[model samples]
Target: MSAAAPSAQPKLRVKNATKAYNTRSGELVAIDRCSLDVKAGEIVSIVGPSGCGKTTLLWSMSGLHKLSSGEVLLDGKPVNGPNPEIGMVFQDANLLPWRNLDANINFPFEIKGTKPDRAWIDDLLGRVGLSGFGGRFPRELSGGMQQRAALVRALSFKPSVLLMDEPFGALDAFTREEMNQLVEEIWMAAPTTIVLITHSIEEAIFLSDRIVVMSPRPGRVAAVHDVPFARPRSLEIMSTREVFDLTNVIKREIVGEQKSRYVRSSDAPVAQSAV
Candidate 1:
């Protein structure tokens, strides 16, 4: 008889992670005993209401913030600090005003004391529709263009995992949609493990393999929804009945959490649904 197939291992693991801040009004818990697992080359998005500690959880996963308890592990090793294997893209482009687009994308290489791969950088620029705009400074580019450059910069080093915190939040609706399409195209061309934080349920549904919903303050994983659509998804998928039903389900979960005045900080049972 043939041997049994081995289960795929998670490229990134968050085990009982908790983060707290000592605010002026005593200690405030941001996230409590939140745990998640992301397989290699999969895109997972976290959606929740504002101040639900989604960003805090993403930051903790990136090793930008330390956890008060539990741990984030990459490749089965604890992540105590920023690892070169992880790349981040923030809401703002955060590009250097003085540096042109080409230089900005090469910044990671410089930081690592390595030479930039001109060919690869150019290919990335072309892929994102910024081929000839490399010489242009951030100020000269539109908001969408700036974000494209930022995305390229984060991917320039070819990190194993990419963490995006509402990277397209600043763009107009039309432009944001365009960027979303662009991101999907890029991911299809070269798959990467991505963990995204967003308030837009539609965005999460469009982009993620799994959607993780968090409770309000002192966030915990309230639910996890597996997206059923195949890869290379189009905007039309957003209007489908499956997408609409899934969106409503997730919205209800967030709304239910918000209505509850008292939220538990300790670990709670997480609901999982496949759609």
Candidate 2:
């Protein structure tokens, strides 16, 4: 299916974005004319090869790194730098060890010098299953728990757009799946536009409304896929023929090779819009 007409102004718009870095060897183009539009409350995932400019594109979107050319806009306004409306979560939780869970999650509020409501913070904590551990330190939490707290902390201010760079990359298989479930739950509870960068095709298919596949090195949009599944999706769906076929399509888009020994059924249509 083709991309649907956006219902409203995109929460985030990356317009012909390009980034180049000066290396000792020469000027290297990290990303070339990559563009994307993410609607409000939508979840989009980006996947590509290891050397692709996926992370660089994310940094530009977050305004952490300026684009060499093109622009990133939030709510139709140019994103020149870090905006309060945008929240970011890195691969590492990066929680302050000196502080307790409450303080760690409240760091965003503290930076703004605003006292967040105790009840609200408690509710956010509870959403991630950290209900009774507000006063506990980061050391007391597991890897998944720490990541959960990180997610809550990022959402504390009710940002319109959330940028996540492989937030569950460090976790084991079980923990990553748990985090994915937690994120989906929190997203349904409080909808926000999310742009996630991940290397795993299965993770992208399981979590995103659309998946953007990028080419290697000087990254470019190779294909865009619309996930044909309803929300409140279960892990069981991942094993379905539809999902497995879609995963292979994305893999082939990224790698340009097909290793699946099974032959494609004529009924199976590779649903993707090639760029």
Number of the top-ranking candidate, with lDDT as the measure: 1
- Which lDDT tens digits does candidate 1 get at residues 148-225? 999999988888999999998889988988888888888888888899998789989888889999988789999999
TM-score of model number 1: 0.92
Best by TM-score: 1
* Clash count (model 1, backbone only): 0
Off by over 4 Å in 1: 1-6, 262-275
- Tens-place lDDT per residue, model 2, 1-275, is 12446577887899999999997656788899999998888899999987678999999999999999999999899999988999999988888999998888889888898878777668888888899887889899899999999998888888889999999999999999988888888888888889999988888988899999988767988899999788888999999999999998888877672212112322344311111
lDDT of 1: 0.88
By summed lDDT, the worst window of 10 consecutive residues in model 1 runs over: 266-275
User: What TM-score goes with each of the models?
Assistant: 0.92, 0.89
Q: How well does candidate 2 score on lDDT at residue 100?
A: 95
lDDT (Cα, 0-100) at 49 in candidate 2: 83
